[model samples]
Target: MESFADLSHFLRSHRLRTAPAETGVSTGAGPRTAPCLLPAELARAAGLDADRYADIEDGRAGRVSLSVLHALASALHLDADDRAELFRLGASPGTSRLRGLGHLTRAVPMLPVIAFNHRYDITGWNLPGQALLAWDLDWPVEHVQPNLARMLFLGRATRALYGNGNAHGQRQVAGLVGALRRAVEQHPDEELTRLVVELAAGSREFAELWARPAEERSDEDDCGVLFRFEHPAVGLMELSRVVLEEGAQNGEWAVVFSPEPGSASAAALDDLLARVSGRPC
Candidate 1:
């Protein structure tokens, strides 16, 4: 049950432990003979003052330059997916028009268009969303719980699609629990209260994060989830999820796509999209 802070710490540690060799920097004997580099060493390698970088790593600061994060990721030799995740963790959430639409929800033009309320309940979804979810479009949105966090852990297809299901599920639950805590602080009510209680009751991981006072919220703009899916007919693919907020009701849209061009998965997704749109598979 790692909080976002915990995940940040883990990533920092992982980066430090793997930096020296990857960066091709040798720690000249003496007292600095450790295999891994410290925050200072990492900072030095990335051409920054160690204290400032340490502040960012310790969560004392809200802003982190993307250039710095990228430099660090490159120094650490992170793969494309991990590098993208690092950059995402540093971006700010963009403001949107769909921020205050009350309880009503409507899908935007984003791929896999879906909308949910502050409680993470599904309110609207487009055709592409139904295809991606493998869900029946005829059903009422109210009948389906659209909480992405809940579905990642509870839904068969979603869970199976997330290759590192447990870790990803826990991280999302922690984030949603963190959001719920903020909502409670602003305006306590029956629905928000009930949703919190229900989520706690239903998910052990969510309960654990809820029990702990939430750490500082992550930069919503910088956070992304990676999902790996294997369709019955399309084969295997990986998608990077980008969450965009719509209105004041805390409505969100998640868009998924492959990172690499001309890959089998990309071809498969394009084919699926064509078929779903009544074009061609």
Candidate 2:
């Protein structure tokens, strides 16, 4: 079995293989052309000497610093949870979990909150989350397998439900892979390590992005990603995401969505829910 150390090494190697062009990092490159961002480009983006940045990714020299990690996270466009994971990996293993980490997810506000782990498996969700998705809370987590990426890519209704579906799906996939990379770095013994590798192999886009170093972002700013949804009753809806975390359990993430108040999208969501459940909107 692979240890956490082995997982970390695998993550680093996988990250290095993905490059800028693979993730649509366009700088006047033709659509057919995929360009690799050399060490200098990465160094410049991270505000480090090319050799120093290379050494860090290579695991040959230099300590992983917060500033450097932040820079890389920005360059890679990681979401909040993924960024937090990176920070955890950069810190001493014993000192990684933050105080009050899972509080937000556990707390039930008006909105729906669905929690997933680093591997994108559903762990828990609030009542609203169950209602929004029209899911039965009593179902087994494994049976639901509430993976946003998987749902978007494989679910029957996902494409119809999300406007900007392609971009939204790509971003979510990239973000999940980024988080997985950090998790592999922190806990190689994790069973999800092989699962991630197998999934990446099946996706060219994922394989490409997985080869590059990950980027990080603050949880607050990372929450909202713009998209649109199409409901059978609602027609079309504009949407955004809010991600909440619950420490470092390896598979915990919270995702929520909202439409503008009093907007058509909101009304549509209400109507759609009512129609689906035969309840008043």
Candidate 3:
């Protein structure tokens, strides 16, 4: 299956990002200090034999055990989403014990919260989020559901919310492009492919960026981005966009906006939340 190669890539990428210092894996008697963890080092950290880990990484192992997958996930310091993805790619292909936790977004009423999947489909949002983005969370019967990529590329108003034709804008667009490509790589489907084709045909900027080699593009917003939003009500406010993996196996991401404490942005956010308090989501 292609998932095997995807799993191998995912594990290798995470392993490369993890350092020996982080894992506390000793480099034996030799005075060799490599930057990233070696395959054997990762195996030792996960309490697995070197050969077993090597087989897994090389895609020679068939149907890895859950215990081993958990061990590797723990050793790799994977977050909720990464852990979920690991389990999906390693232990079980279609079986998922965790799902449908998007309601957690409503728990944080003070900040604008949006929940989306790898497909960029906006699954859930709180009233503050709806108000913050001026997005009608409740689409009409004839209207389509909200999607981040579609809004960014297709909707003029949503495009205006991001950075304009500058470095910041370029970074934002390139990040989205990288993210979309990664999403398609992980989960190949007609819908996702159709979205890419549609964007390439409709958006010249998207087409240009999408045409660029994957190695040439940088995904700077993998964790989050310092988003400067032009809120219609609060005016210009700089909020740190924090992206956390929601506790679900559906590849959901919880995107939260936080402003510096005691700043004008924070005060404006407070006022905005207060105004929307007790309102329908």
Candidate 4:
């Protein structure tokens, strides 16, 4: 796996790799080659002070405004996707009332659903959903919030639970990092920041993937995915997952898994559901 550096390191590295000529800065006559701009020079081009710009990369300057972020993007010559990612990093995780709720779960007819916020915090899981994943929901264990990323990386039974464990684990980790890296950059002050910081410091896998550039991670436009769960009791369960975002923009998403029609996996799922529910009340 390729290990990646944080935004600060990434920005610094890109800046070094870019030539002065590319940004329309002139290099003094040397037969050798044109050089990259120093931090000071680049900052000047961005119309920002060197210290403030450094703070932007490090995420120290709180709540970077749109104008300033755009200026930096323009100065860095970031493309459309890069600009979108940069914007996500700069945006705030709008105030959400996710933590205080007694239960974060939601009910959808004839489907197994789990709810989570943009930060990947697993808020709720339907009984069928729980039967599929088979993990306890005890959260904020000594201040560490229970989220999907933690389970995938730290849980003992997590890998065994997945039919395609190793590959899926890596893919999930990568996707989680891609989602989270932007969040940390966005609201490095909120409760979720604690989760991100702790995971980054504690989990090497999480850290390495989080450092990967956005383009290297999963596509943000992907509507859903296909997953297979190797449940201990049920054997195998395959389903297509679609993330249904609540209209409120509160960052909550309902993850629903739909079993395929006339598939063995679907039959197994039906049997498992019946065994668990025992003739629905």
Candidate 5:
């Protein structure tokens, strides 16, 4: 409710920013000549009844569905960042989770940090994470954030990064599926369901993993799985993977990779950091 309080203001501001021509709504002649679209015009564009839209815009709607939020975002012509913020503002109670993603990455300098919610949607990564993972920081903000399971099962770069190829990748995905199973059972989230459905449809490996019994899955090493990456920039590197839970109830966690001190992997990581920071190693 604390965050939801801002939803009205957010919607109003965006609606004000929306041009009449953008949504194809003509500015009526009764002194409404400002570039902004009227509430009724926005409601028509968003396909909601005028009263319903007014309730939502007035903070009187107790809970708005994701579908409605998506509609509003599309009608407003919001870009990715604004869309993300719209969802955050419209999120139902008990769904508010995680510190600011960028802040979390900045909290730990020189370390590669990848954080996600219960749904495993990649929220943010720091410089080291971008350098090590070859994540294109230059990508347009509208680009969808990478999902972990999707990366493991469908991404060529991620597959190539796995030192042992498919075998290692499958193991990693099995671990992810195992965690997802727990999250799905506990939360019954819509985004998580969509992710599972998408991956199962796209990747045979993910479908097979998801089909297996929980007892038969081998995700016991999820806490600290040892990963070896054949990084294009740094060659072979070994790091211990640690999952740090950010919020106990939110199912948010940060994946951190740390190398043993005085090892080749450590040197490789240092070089990566230097490259990212523009400092000589």
Candidate 6:
């Protein structure tokens, strides 16, 4: 079981980025400080034993106390939002009591929108959404709904959609893997377990990448980031992905792709969508 990997990474990176003076810690004479506190120093500041803090940093700590978390947050001068993220990251895996999604209940026609449940299951997508991502609308109704991780790591269509093994495609795939890692650590569902096992069995890339700790994976946005995809129909196009989350705990995140306006990419999308709309069902 993973234990606060995200929290630890955030802590360590924040520590490194923070200067000694900022934290009211002294830099010893005769040499410039590295601008970060040692694990022992940080532990002392957070009122925890050195070894215990070391365990947390290395992800060996099984669980941590709220007092210690509060102490660390205070010591690090973390803001409310980051403190909340830290707590969420450090939370027990079983704490994910997510609600089931009913409907998307929202739409933005200027962008292609698709929503996913907590399990990262693709629950809903708009008309332009399918064409924008070049999805196969003819997938038989008998099959299970498509998932982002599986579609990215296991499907052959991903290559065509993302540019046939382009660097951008690989990065996008890795980011999705990271997001999946985050979800897996937060919730341990039998369905998710099966998905992981199935992907690991079939996809060497997924298996190898997933083996790495979440902290080591890129913490970049899985969506809502600008990226270029070489669409076979639209040619090279850049899109800004926006992810909007619904509900509180269930938090169904919808990803919206909007072509960058006043650019060739936008024009290409316009032409492509027109052609797609003209096609017969």
Maximum-lDDT candidate: 5
The predictions' CA RMSDs to the true structure, in order, are 18.5, 20.6, 16.2, 20.3, 7.3, 18.7
Cα error of candidate 1 at position 238, Å: 3.1
Clashes per candidate, residues 3 or more apart or on different chains: 9, 18, 0, 0, 0, 1
Clashes in model 3: which pairs? none
Report the candidate with higher lDDT, 3 versus 6.
Answer: 3
* Per-residue lDDT of candidate 4, residues 22-73 (tens digit): 6775444666343676776678778899899877666576566656765766
In order, what lDDT does every prediction score?
0.53, 0.53, 0.69, 0.59, 0.71, 0.63
Error of 5 at 137 (Å): 6.7
Error of 1 at 275 (Å): 6.8
Candidate 5 lDDT over residue span 189-240, tens digit each: 7777988999899888789889998855455465667787888677778888
Task: Compose the digit string of candidate 2's lDDT tens values, residues 221-254.
Answer: 4567655555544577665677655554543445
Model 6 / residue 78 / CA error / Å = 49
Model 6: which residue pairs collide?
224-241
Residue-level lDDT tens digits of model 1 in 1-281:
22235336745876657747667665666775566777777777777787877876776656466566656666666542344344445532321123222112122222454444555554444444545655322322223235555664456565454444466545654565676676677646687687777767886756777789668865652335555565544656666665555444443433333335676766777666676665211
- Model 4 TM: 0.52
Better candidate by TM-score, 4 or 5? 5
**Considering TM-score, which of the candidate structures 3 and 4 is the better prediction for this target?**
3
Residue 83 CA error for candidate 1 (Å)?
Answer: 38
> In candidate 5, what residue range of length 10 has the lowest lDDT sum?
135-144
Instruction: Please give each candidate's TM-score.
Output: 0.46, 0.48, 0.57, 0.52, 0.60, 0.56
Instruction: Give the Å error, residue 179, model 1.
Output: 2.8
Q: Which has the higher lDDT value, candidate number 1 or candidate number 3? A: 3
TM match of model 2 to true structure? 0.48
Better of 5 and 6 by lDDT: 5
